[model samples]
Target: MKVIVTDEISEKGLELLQKDPRIEMDVRLGLSKPELYEAIGAYDAIITRSGTQVDAELLSHATNLKMVARAGVGIDNVDVAAASEKGIIVVNAPFGNTNSAAEHTMAILLSLCRNVPGANSSLKSGEWQRAPFTGYELKHKTLGVIGLGKVGGRVARRARSFEMDVVVYDPYISEKRATDFGTRLVDLDELVQIADVITVHTPLNDETRDLITAEHFAKMKDGVLIVNCARGGIINEEAMLNALNSGKVVGAAFDVWSEEPPQGDVIRQLIEHPRMIVTPHLGANTFEAQTNVAVDVSKEILNLLDGRPVENAVNIPRFDPDLMAQMGPFMELARVLGDFISQLAPENPGKVSFQYNGKLAAYDCMPITVAGLAALLDRCTDQEVNMVNANLVADRRGLVVEQGRSTESEFFSNLITL
Candidate 1:
């Protein structure tokens, strides 16, 4: 199979793909939009970073493209919905940069607290100004961690080693998880009010975007420090600058920004501020991170070529590898049954439910349900409905989809009923 590398990746990763006898990999960088669209049709798979925009127009030209492998965690640049419609699998290395990001957070947080950057610049410029550069210690400080996922959890552990009290504010995490991490779970309002240092590690979405706004900052302790290494829009840039100016925030350490290559006055003012520490989104820029992400996506591509289930597909449902062979027959059966049932059912059957019976109910049944859903909705929608776009189409059509599992099945050893 032919694979193309449209963007730069670690040599280690390129070597891995090159060494595979069954695959032929090509690296073509700085290709214009028209050139990329034309050349993409020849490759079965593509490996790229954020530079390549895998959108609908490009995908339209990629007639033979099977997979899009992103070397990094974020898939924002890639139009996932568009890829899904074309039955192209999109994958990314989500865990490869966990340590790098967590470490960067600590680096900036320490640098901000100790005024390391300013002091280093001062001494290098031939001045030994010690008193002005002197800053506070992390010990005995209350650290409020927002979001206790992989990176945040690691940050909490590292902060504990510095003798800092770690408190978390993730509604999804269990109480047991908080206790296991040795961090107290608190509400967002409480965390902002009590934390001497606050760091955000949440995904930027409707709920989390502008999460730390002027209102939230107003509740913070005087001279409270802030750190954001996750995403750009999680914190309000305008409010952050105002806080820094008013001295309500002692300092802020940011690795990511609302706009990468940040523009305008609010972002510029934050970076130029005396007490703020900024890096140009370098959380995942470490040598090790680059190699790790490359290796991860390469291995996933190999898995797909071997007809194995993809672990990190953005648009596909993942099933346990061991159970895949056993589930394959049922999946096809599910789809055929859905097609047959839809023909008999009345018009506007408001809710469609997939019921898994017998031994199959013991494991994950979502994939089977999705397969059935695709066939059932195929005639109802204008689009070519498949497992990849079934859920999205169902939502758009205002159809309620549900699933159930039951161990008791008198008819057969395994069954997928809709």
Candidate 2:
């Protein structure tokens, strides 16, 4: 199997692929977008970090691409839904850089609080600026944590060590978990209003993008510090800039930007602002993180070539091999029925439901339902719909997907209804 490494990755991680006799690995850097698209047809898989934009356009050109391996945690650069529709599996190393990102978040927060850059610059320029660079102490301060996942959890622990009271806002986690982490569970509104320091650690998804807007900033206390070392656009960059200017936010540190390579006038002005500290997306820049992430994806690629289950797939779910065998043959049949339903239903057909009975209902019927959904979307939308992304596409289009199963069939030993 042939694999293309489009972005720069650690040599330590690529060694696994390099030594493998079954895999053909190529490092082709600085390929133009068109070049990448045109050349991708020959490769079975591609590996990337954050630099490459793996969207539908690129997937269309990758006629033979079976998989996409993201070397790091974020798949923000990769259009996962598109790849899934194309029958391409997407995987990522979600855990490899946990410490690196968490540490960076705290590092930037401290830098912002202490005016480290300005103080260092002043001292180097021959000046004593002890009073001007006076900073806030973490002790007794309320630290509000947003999305207490891997990185946020670590940051909270570190803040607790500083004697800072930590409040977490993660609806996904239980209040018990928050207490274990030395944090009190709070809502976004309460966190914003009370926290002396606020840090975001959520992924950049539809729900989280621009999560902390101008309204949230308005609710903040004066001189409240903010930090965003997670995904960009989560805190609303423009709103942050406005808050910095208006003194609604006394100091802010951001390691990631809405646009990488930090473009636009607002970002430039934010960078120039004395109260704001910025870094070029270096959240996962640690040597250990780079190697760990690379090794993770490399192992997955090897897993694919070795006929082992790719465990970290973002698009495809892990299923028992035996169960897949039962559902595999029905995919075509389910798809045909879905196609029929697509043509038979009205333009604004509200919701879709699937029923499985008898033998079919005995097994997990999710794959068959998804296959039908893919066909349903094939005619209704321009997106390339397949079993992998059918349910996702259905949800995004506001086409509710519902399913039911029964042990007995009305007329046949096994039956599927759409």
Candidate 3:
């Protein structure tokens, strides 16, 4: 099997692939679109970050490609639907940079609170202005966390250690989880109104796109500090600017932007703003995170090649030859049943129930349930719905899923009713 690393991957992951006698690896960076199009057909697997776009056009040419691994969380750069239709597996390292991103968020938040950027520049310029560079303590301040997943959970723990009161608003996470993390669970409105510092750690989706808009800004406390280590556009740039100008937001730190390598008037203005601290999307830029993601995604690619179950596949089923053979036509029937049930469900289903009958009960029905859930929720959420987080993603949208089995069937030996 041949593998291509088109983007800069950690040397450690490359070494792993090199040591495998069954696989041949190539590092082909800085390839133009036409060059990638021409060469992709020869490789069986490809690994990339955000630079290379694996679209329908590219996948169409990649006749021999069996898998594409993204060494990071987002797959916005890949044409997932096309890859699925082509029977190509797509994998990503969703947990590789959890610590790195959480730490970066804390770093930026601290910098904003203490005016570190301003102080550093002033000292470098040979000015000793301690009064103007006065810092604020995090103790007793309310910290609002937008998303309470991996990174957000870490941030909440760290903030609590600093004696800061943490309030979280993640519809997906249970109130018990938030309480366990030493955070008070609150609604978006409450968080916005009371928090002294607000941090975002959610994916970019339709519901979250420009989530913190002008109206939201208007509701926030004056002099509230804002941090975004998640995707761009979660906080509306225009609204932030207006808030900054109007003295509603005292300081803001942004690592991601709505646009990469931001250009034109808005970006220029934001970067030049004295109260705003911006980095060029450095949330997952640490050496440790990069290497971890490389190794993680490489392992997933190898798993796919070896016909083993892939853990972080961004699609349903994961295309297991042995499992598919055993399941036979029942798999197809289950999927169709799931589809039928999902269509009859409400616009935002609160729960999904899957009942298995007869011989289907003998086989493990977890994969079937996941496939059904993915098919159902994919129609709702903007983010890619896959087996990895289908149930969790459903829970995020206030949906619950239950699966049951029985040894009774009417027509087929095994039956799946959703």
Candidate 4:
């Protein structure tokens, strides 16, 4: 199998790929759109970072492509829907940069609290200004962390070592998990009201977009320090500027911006502000993180080539071994029926009905129904829909789904209705 690394990947990962005799690898860096289109057809797998756009037009030319591996967490740069339609599996290394991002968050937070950047500038200018750069101690301070996932959990643990109180907000995580992390679970309002420092670590989605708006900022404690190492646009830029000016927020550090390479008026002001600490999206810039992500993506590509299942696959179904074989044939039939139904139905499907006929009716049909649901809605949903939560996605979209099975005899041994 042939694999192409179209962007800059770590040397460690490249070494592993080179040692694998079953795979042939190529590195094509900084290629133009036309150059990439011309070169992509020969490879079975393509590995990339944010620079490459895996869109419909590009996938059209990739006749031999089976998998696309992204070296980072976010899949925003790749057109996942387009790739899925062409039967391409997309995978990403979501956990590889967890430590790197958490470390960067702490780095920025510490720098802002201690006024490191200003002090460094003053010393370089041959000035001894110790009194002006007085820093605050992190001990006894309240650290509020949003989204208590991998990176957030790590930050909370590290903060506790400094004798700081950690509070977290994540509705999805269980109470047991938060207790295990030794963080006080609280609502967003309470966190804002009590926290001395606030840090965000949530993915950008419809519910989380502008999560920290004007009202939320108003609720924050006066002189609160804010940090965002997650996605841009989670905090409203205009509202943040207003809070900064009003003294509601004392200092801010942002590694990600709503518009990358920030160009607007508010972004320019934030970048120029002396009290604001900003980086060019370097949360995952550490060498260790890069190597981890590259190695993870490489392994995923190799797995796809060998016709084995991938653990971090973003577009494929994750199934149990015993059940996978039993339901394998039904999945194909479901896919064909789903495709046919979707084309024949209206622009928006209000409901989907699944009916099972013949001797196969005695078996549990929930998994089959979900598999069919995934196929029908795979091309429509923004997020990846698998058999695990296909029904939930359908429910979220206000689509009613019904399932029924019968033991009546039919021409075929089993029949599935949609």
Whole-model Cα lDDT of every candidate shown, in order: 0.90, 0.89, 0.86, 0.86
Per-residue lDDT of 301-379 in model 1, one digit per residue for the tens? 8988897667788898757667788887888898899899879877777789888889889988888888888899887
lDDT minimum window of 10 residues, candidate 1: 379-388
TM-score of each: 0.88, 0.81, 0.80, 0.78
Q: Global lDDT for candidate 3?
A: 0.86
Pairs in steric clash, model 3: none
| Best-performing candidate as measured by lDDT | 1
Q: In candidate 4, what are the lDDT values of residues 114-225, reduced to their tens digit? A: 9999999999999999998998889999999999988999999999988999999998988889889989899999999999999999888778889999998988889999
State model 1's lDDT. 0.90
Between 1 and 2, whose TM-score is larger?
Answer: 1
RMSD of 2: 5.7
Candidate 4: misplaced stretches above 4 Å? 319-418
Per-residue error for 2 in candidate 3, Å, reads: 1.5
**Residue 164 error for model 3, in Å?**
0.9
Q: Rank the candidates by TM-score, best first.
A: 1, 2, 3, 4
- The lDDT, on a scale of 0 to 1, for candidate 4 is 0.86
Q: What lDDT tens digits, residue by residue, belong to model 3 across residues 290-383?
A: 9899989878877876865677887655445566667646655665666677677778877788899997697778787877787777767676
> Could you tell me which 10 consecutive residues in candidate 3 have the lowest summed lDDT?
316-325
Write model 2 residue lDDT over 208-263, tens digit each, in one string. 99999999999999999999989989988889999998999999998888888877
